[model samples]
Target: MQFENTREFARQLDKEDKLSRYRHEFIFPKVNGKEVIYFVGNSLGLQPRSAKKYVDEIMKDWAELAVEGHFYADKPWWDYHERFSEKLAKVVGANPSEVTVMNTLTVNLHLLMVSFYRPSGKRYKIICEEKAFPSDQYMINSQVRFHGYDPEDAIVEIKRREGENNFRTEDILQKIQEVGEECALLLIGGVNYYTGQVFDMETITKAGHDVGAFVGWDLAHAAGNIELKLSEWNVDFAAWCSYKYMNSGPGNASGCFINKKYHNKKDIPRFEGWWGHNKERRFLMEPEFHPEPTADAWQISNAPILALAPYLASLEMFDEVGMPALIQKRNKIVAYLEYVLQEIDKDVESTFEIITPAEQEDRGTQLSVFLHGEGRELFNYLMEQGVITDWREPNVIRLAPAPFYCSFEDMYEFGQILKKGILSKQKV
Candidate 1:
């Protein structure tokens, strides 16, 4: 499809878009009395209009029922997090029994590591991507330290080829093979936060397993933005935050996927609490912990009802629209965004080099552009003009055109604004 940098073309595309109407479901921020074209869904999603209703329901229940709300509220606060299992399983392509909602992303990762990241005398090293999200780096480093190992020896980072912006699948596979028996675990972000590259999880998971290593993914960016089949991939475990593409509020609850093979295992070690106990026998309060025979076995505490409320609200929308529809729009819109960037670059003296993978399958909704011959002034101009985007160090701006709310018109308008910002700088 030929993409044109014109309002009419953008409007025509939006008119044909089946997902266009869903944009109204969200509330956007204003800059100078107009709704901004939001491009930072990779950072934080816009608030779902239904989020307040979800939260208010919980608030009303707490007011009316007091402590009894745990058992009698409309959602039943004691089992609130259970509501996410079915819907979230669909989103991440896992069985309902294999999925659960619990603590925040990094926290869940830490908890999951208790079971998946076991290291022994001869096999203690972990393989991860080079320059992983800072939080992940910190988590891995701390986990290794807690296990009494130096990060320098225990962490094997798969570096990108010297001058490349992304990791090659062969390089990743080769590194996994090289790590061999020493590799206790192989975990990497499903969607790279920096270059927006989508790794080949199925193949990588198989490679990890073949090498006698546990494999998992940090799906912070991949959970709702790209296609995932955690169970089919035979991933041992995975975790993702709901506040990004999932459209839950800030620092909201996270979703986890644990393979059914790991369920009800007596040998598997985990950090457990009352919520993970058998529901029918939980009130008994026996001293021994009998974990629930599913992913909930990883739960360390009771569900945070208020936090899960907005997440449930967003999951309902995902169920209604389905991932196939979202991915369809995502592919077209991201391509159109790339086309707009190219067209705008042609008009301006500055060059916009999209560091993200060119193939649709190798990328998701985000395009990380290397703004050559430009600086922070352009980013500031964009922000002031209500173009909400994310700025990384060294003149890179991450633009994620979230399919549910972002529109083709936003892409075209952003191109215009970008051209103006660049030309304005040249005149100075």
Candidate 2:
């Protein structure tokens, strides 16, 4: 538990790590002929070494079977996405019947809104966290506009207490209550992208429902990085991209969860397509849309087989390792990363203020640190030295020591590199 900033100490921890060997499963980028210590898994995950094989299988199938690949390929392109339901349900803590893979994150959210974001008369306002991911902001704004309401009046943002970096749970619940009868939808990022705060989704979902609002989560960061029980939480709906911690390729397919309560409801409005029709009767091509009695009912088009291939590859790994193992390593590694940052700050003139919540339960793999008396030069120096991290505006660098590939040694080495960068800047 006592984290020391030394290579030996880091190596000792790594030796004790059960997940250490899994690092070899991924292919890392090289800087100056050495694999970089990757910390940007929150932005984009490193390519799974098996991803090529998955894609190649699909390519080979397309070549061999042509249009018949839909029925003849090893994965059978028509039912390709069905492979994800069981594995992905385990990852997000939902039933296989409650989850499905479909379009990208924002696109799924838009489609899900057709079923969940119904606003009429007095119950028209939507409650979301302040400064949500830009894409979410744009989606909410556009959705409100499309429904013929001013965003200023229809969108209720729960602001953090003046100087706080994260929104308090009480503040969020109170805001939901305050929105009250006017709250038609409550959608928030399960883990905040900026501060790396994990919202109390279960409690918030209850609060939203108590106020007669439809609740959902944008799990872009939370899906694989944190433990989620979307079904137990009774979340009405949720969506997440596979490209981040899920380790699918960039802009890959997304996963969704719709509560079983919403399934097979003809009255529930949705933008339907042929894929959502009853599979047994789909070939009949009847004019009326008889929805599939599960989350797949929201599917507006056929599965993107090529896109889902890499995702299936990654999900197999997740199934093999399990989330409990991932979360165990995530907690220890993130704490070690924080300790390394603190140790380096003690030695350097620059200050590293971690804005992420100190509690393990309140945070995930990411540590958003404000580098006082430092600038983008530090970030550039890090990148050049084979340290891949993400930089936000105003001297904040987001370091996500993903448990999948990030080692404890990486934490120690990054501390050394960071200290050197700061000391070198002072000499100038």
Q: Quantify all predictions' global Cα lDDT against the true fold.
A: 0.94, 0.94
Query: How many Å off is the CA of 26 in candidate 1?
Result: 0.4
lDDT of 2 by residue, 1-428 (tens): 77788999999999999999989999999999999999999999999999999999999999999999999988898888889999999999999999999999999999999999999999999999989999999999999999999999999999999888999999998898888999999999999999999999999999999999999999999989999999999999999999999999999998999999999888999999999999889889899999999899899899988899889998999999999999999999999999989988888888899999999999999999999999999999999999999999999999999899999999999999999999999999
Q: Which stretches of candidate 1 lie over 4 Å from their true place?
A: none
Model 1 lDDT-worst window of ten: 343-352
TM-score: model 1 vs. ground truth: 0.99
Q: For candidate 2, which ten residues in a row score worst on lDDT?
A: 343-352
Stretches of candidate 2 off by over 4 Å are: none
RMSD of every prediction: 0.7, 0.7
